[model samples]
Target: MAKKQHYKHNNGAMYLMLSPYLLLLFFFGILPAIMGVLEIPKPSMANANGGWDAFKIVIHDFRFGPALRHVLGFMGIFVPLMIFFVIGMALMLDIKHSPWKKWLRMAYIVPASISGAVAVLVWYVILQPTLSPIKGVLRYFHITESSQIWQQQNLVYILAIMAFFAAAGNWILIQYGSLQSISTEVLEAARVDGASVWQTAIRIKLPLISKYIVYMSVLVFAGGLQIFVEPQLLNGGIYQGIADSWSFDQLSYNLAFMQGDFGGASALSILLLIPSLLGALLVIFKTDMFEGAQGHIKKKDVEIVGI
Candidate 1:
């Protein structure tokens, strides 16, 4: 009877500890998500027929398809490259006996401390048409009279590169943490068994860290989907080659603030939520990550019969 009362008291304390976070999530996360799906009038409803009609107009606008395509294209180019580079750097840093490892790790993580918007601004200055370092190089080589790299479609690739440079450091830290959690004894046994570094990485390290890789991939993909500040700050938030609404987040921003169509923005926001929610579900269910079932299967059955 005393133990039962003690257990109940502990449970009450635990609930009290969790109440703040639960309340915060309820008000900020759940409430906003529910409100986003609810039908609301556009601020410009008087000017544009009605809320539903305003939403339709925004959806059917000429820029919608092209903007979505541009964002998707940028994600396609950036996410995979960042994942590969971050994982590789993490592996390199995970070498415990390497010289200068501390400095190398610090260098990799330094970019993560910088804000995304600030990083974009710095890159914009570096990649400007006239004062760019590349421009100086080209001029020295007599390659062209002016720097036109930022004017062409190639600017998308440059933007992707800048994003990778700014964000890859944080991902490298995540991957490194996962790598460090792996058992050193297993690696030593593999080395004693004459397994080469490449072979061990492929067969052991990669398999062990597969779940972390998947998690990072999903997280980065979702983040890439919501990209705004980098492109907006870099391109001056105009409808130029890459428009103001190039990303889904930017689309919602343009609808609500620029066009005064809150209903349309909410609809677009709900659409954006779908991909992120689906990606999260996939990470939770489709992968062996959350359940710790990656490589725990044991005992394969074998049958022998008279031939």
Candidate 2:
């Protein structure tokens, strides 16, 4: 009776904690997706009266190829670097009795706290050799000219770096917290079994936290596809056409607002969403991520999964 009661209590607490995220996901993610799907069939100038024509128009656009390449390039650099560094730094921080752990955690999140237009402005200044505090370093890298740093070829690398720093801090702390969920007893056993720290982290901790890594990958990939602000702001703020519609998101924005083709935008968004959605479903359903150690899905998880 007591065990059942405790389990129910835990379930309630879990749902309570998840409620805010659920609400946001429903409102911002699911609702928008639904709306985008509906809007896909609506008539539009870009589509010349929409009905999958919007999809054709968007996919066939000249900007589409470059945008896809740019975003793919950003993800190629950002996602791996993010996963590697975030896990590495989190593991480094999780070392027992590390004196600087708390300070380092705080340092990691400071950049994340600086957000929105401010982050854009800050990055702009930082990337500019003449204005940046690290001008000497920029010059060392042969980026003395804004022309050098802001070129078409260098934009992918630049965007990747900017996105990585902006996001890595928060992910590091999240992954670190995930690390803390690991059983100290298990870690002790690993040590007792002559497993070195590296071996334990690689062989034990990494596998234990694999689900979180998948979650991060899905979100990171989705966010990478939705890259808009950096390219858009950079284009408008400094160089007028350098990264103009350099991402699919920017292209969608231009289609909807500039070109007055909401249907095309919605179709494009749906097309972009398919990969992230499929990837998430594959990870979630194929793995035993939501299952308990007993090889059954937990009741709470089952209920959520059903929904």
Candidate 3:
């Protein structure tokens, strides 16, 4: 009777604790998701036509192909490079007792606190060709005389660097946390067997932390797909290199405000939500990410008869 009462009390406490999150999920997450899929009636079409023409038009738009390609290209370059550099930096800093670890970690995390816009502005100053500090060095070696790093062709590289600078530090912190969670006894055992640091890292540590790396990679990839402000701000808005509807988000913004096409904008917004939704699903279900592998293990006793 006491155990039954205890269980009931625990169940009530759990429900009480979960109520706030349930409320938020229903109102914010589930509601918005449902509304996003529903067809919105447009003022312009209320009388002219009552059909799915707006969504069909957005689906067949020429800008859709180029915008998707551009965003995917950015993701291709940004996600892998970000993961490699961030994980490498995290591993280097994970030698917690090393003398320079504190300062090195500090340097990596400092940029994460700065806004993306601010970082882009800083990069613009540094990559401004003639006035840029590196440009002077490049000029000494007879590099180009032009003062623009914001060239049409170089936009991919420029955006990649900007993303790396803005995002790598936060990923490093996540990787570092994962590394810290690893048992010290495992490292000690590898050391006892006279395994070199490189060998241990490759054969043991990396496998252990592989899921964390994949988790961060998918997260960064999703973020890269949603990139907007850096390219827009760097291009000075609606410029030649970056079309008005270069990215999906940019397309939605332009449709809503610039072109005054609310229905089209809403359609674009629903389209843009696809990649993020797929990424989130992949993170949650496709990978053993949120629940670490340690949770799945069970201890069992085996008895041996005297032989």
Candidate 4:
């Protein structure tokens, strides 16, 4: 009984130690969510029955459709491309026999330290027609004029590349660490069983790191849905006919600040948060990411005795 009481006391102390983080989470995450709900029109407001009118206005707006389409389209392209690059780079860097592993990792890690906005801006300059490294090639191909690459119809592709550049390095490092955490004994046993490099990576390593892939995918998708800065900076904000370039978050921002439609903005914000919240919930429920702080199989304790 005394030991159990002591354990309960220790748990209480640990939670007390975590009070700061809990407070931050409450203030920034929970408080804002409550505020967003409160910002909705009351039953006596112009809506007369509550926020449904705001929801209707936001949902029916022409901007909402295009904003949603752009976010979905960007995610459709960006998520897969980013995942492909992240996994590919991680695998290349994890090559057990590779001489340039350290160099490749350093190169990949460099971009992750750059802010997302700054990375996009750098690409903006690099892909500019006259000043770009590929200026001569673009000119030769007649793809260069006074205009920049983001000004073209292929802005979607340009955005994908920029998003990948900004985000994939962090994911690569994550996947690489997960891959490194893989038991070498399992890998050696596969090699002994005549597993080629491709076979090992595809059949063994990939499955082992599936959890990390799923975690990164959910996070990337969530973040991609709320995309704002790249499109805002790229298109110079709120184009009339080209609303597809503006994201939902940008639309919400414009509604709140640019037009002072607080109710409408709140509706849009709640809508935008739905998928993000779902993704976060899925991560929390589906992964061991939050539990016990020990999820990955340790290489040291792994044995190859059976095979």
RMSD to native, candidate 3: 7.4
Candidate 4: deviation at residue 27, Å?
1.8
- The per-candidate count of clashes, in order, stands at 0, 0, 0, 0
**Pairs of residues at least 3 apart in sequence or in different chains that clash in candidate 1:** none
All candidates' TM-scores?
Answer: 0.79, 0.82, 0.78, 0.82
lDDT of 3 by residue, 117-213 (tens): 7876777666656567688676675656443445666667777787888888878888988888889999999989999878877787788999888
- Looking at candidate 1, what is the lDDT of residue 99? 66
RMSD, every candidate, angstroms: 7.4, 5.8, 7.4, 6.9
Clashing pairs in 2: none
By summed lDDT, the worst window of 10 consecutive residues in model 1 runs over 298-307
Clashes of 1: 0
lDDT of 4 by residue, 52-170 (tens): 68888778888878766666777889999988888987887777747667677678778776656686667766776867777887787776654544454565677777787778877
Please report, in order, the local distance difference test score of every candidate based on alpha carbons: 0.72, 0.85, 0.72, 0.75
Model 1: how far is 232 from its true place, Å? 2.0
Deviating ranges (above 4 Å) for candidate 2: 1-32, 283-307
- What's the TM for model 3? 0.78
lDDT measured at residue 62 in model 4 versus the true structure, 0 to 100:
82
Clashing pairs in 3: none
* Sliding window of 10 residues with minimal summed lDDT for model 2: 290-299
Identify the runs in model 1 with alpha carbons over 4 angstroms from their true place.
1-16, 40-59, 129-147, 237-242, 288-307
